[model samples]
Target chain A: MKSVLCILFTFGLWLLLTWSLDPKVVGVGLMMAILVATLLAHIYPDNPHKALDPRRWFWACIYFPYFLVLCIKSNLDVAYRVLHPDLPIRPGIVKIRTRLTSEMAKTFLANSITLTPGTMTVDIVGQDLYIHWINVHGVDAEEHTRRIVRPFEGLLRRVFE
Target chain B: MSETIAQWIIGVGLMFDLLGCLGLVRLPDVYNRLQAGTKCVTLGTCMIMFGTFLYGVAALDRPQMAVQALLCAVFVLLTSPVAAHAIARGAYRAGARLWEGSVIDRLGEDLHGVRPPAERAEPADQPAAVHHFTESES
Candidate 1:
């Protein structure tokens, strides 16, 4: 069932890419989508009906906009620093901890940090994430966690783990 | 009016791209350059694509072109940071030097030499100690 949905979704994207309703184009796209989906379906096997919880979907929708706002804010922040005459950046690699247990949630947190203002996630060894902070505020891990990781941690935890 | 808006968006994107290039030239180290290059370029390219999307939809009345522009924007958003991550990892492993003024070098110490667990002593008062993996005996 999930495979079928995946095929349909891919086929829809194919159609969108071609922007054509012509039967011949669609027929070729359908074959390609089916071939790709069947080959990859086992990798993403559904978890026995547990994946359809609407609450998670709602949180994901909310996450997108919240993340979008963060991205815009971060872009502006970086832009300001770049254009500043003194270039007030104080770059350093700092280690901070995350309470996120799931790998997926940690990934989301890392990517979010990279995209946000003055921070880039360099490496993650265990729960300790080494971030290249363009501006090093302080050395206190607890303080850094509060300012950086805590904001998205709750939302991601709710959505993923 | 719609065309003007699209042009303005494209202009904003160009400004970002220009600033990003400036950053690449002006920033002190590889990590800082990556920060400027990755974030600014990603946002700039995505913005330009988005401007194209808006222009196609509103000014040209062509949904096909608009969709392609949107797809390009989405693809850039998804892939740019991953590229940045790989570059950063490679740079660090290859011994790319940080700026002379850098305050902390946690990864440098951990990967190049070991900091005994005692030096990295966590706040024992926290309940999350058990979940924390002590420094792997390198």
Candidate 2:
């Protein structure tokens, strides 16, 4: 019963985010969503632990605005560095110690870091997140990676595990 | 001011993408280089798409171009990290060693006992401590 609801919800969200908003689009989207949901249910559907958590959803709702602001800000920073005569770039890969225990949190952190500019999570070894930082600013690139990935971890923990 | 700001944003995004490409070529390790390629290119391309979107809105007045730009942005958002993960996992599976300066390898000693290729062929006589997966999975 809950699985059906989850599938419907997931499909609905997918439909909403797609290109069209018309009734035909919505109807097609709904059918596609159901197919996807049903396929997902068959694949690995029985984890009650993956259920909805209000706190996580609340954080997710707010996180987007924060991400947008950072996206714009990072764009400006990268542009400035690009145009500047100095050509500021300290290229290096750094390993960050991840404290999150849950797999979902770690995955969230990994994806979120990639979402933001200037850093990418290239490798994850257990709780250690190996990141490639484009411009190694200030003293601690490792610390910077940790600081950026930290928020996503918290919200992911609340939601998934 | 707004026009200048928009120009600055587009220019910077392009710069970062350029830097990212340079780093991907210049960096020492696969992991390090992948980072440059993934984040920098993804953001840089995104900026270009966004600039196009802005131009579409302010200049051409075409909704289709803006929509296409947005679709590109969404596509980048979804695939960049996934590609990174695939690269990292492929590297690991192919036995690429982690950096020495790394502070910790939480995977170190925690595998269901999967050993490196070199260590795997040691000896059947060696006890459970360095347990071999081949012998056990059978």
Question: Candidate 2 docking: what grade?
Answer: incorrect
Instruction: State residue A21's C-alpha deviation in candidate 2, in Å.
Output: 11
Candidate 2, DockQ to 2 decimals? Answer: 0.15
Which runs in model 1 stand beyond 4 Å of their true positions? A1-6, A22-51, B114-138
Cα shift from native, residue A155, model 2 (Å): 4.3
Tens-digit lDDT string for candidate 2 (B15-72): 8788777755554456555655666777788887888777667677877777777777
Candidate 2 lDDT tens digits, A82-114? 445554555444567766776656666787776
Candidate 1: pairs in clash: none
In candidate 2, residue A30 scores what lDDT? 77
Name the candidate that leads on DockQ: 1
lDDT tens readout by residue for model 1, A2-93:
78877987898999889999999999999999998988877553453435877777888998898878887777877888888777787778
Distance from true position, residue A94, model 2, in Å? 7.9
Report the Cα lDDT for residue A45, model 2: 39
lDDT of 1 by residue, B42-135 (tens): 8889989999999999999999999999998988987888788889988787656576656677787778686444543443443452233211
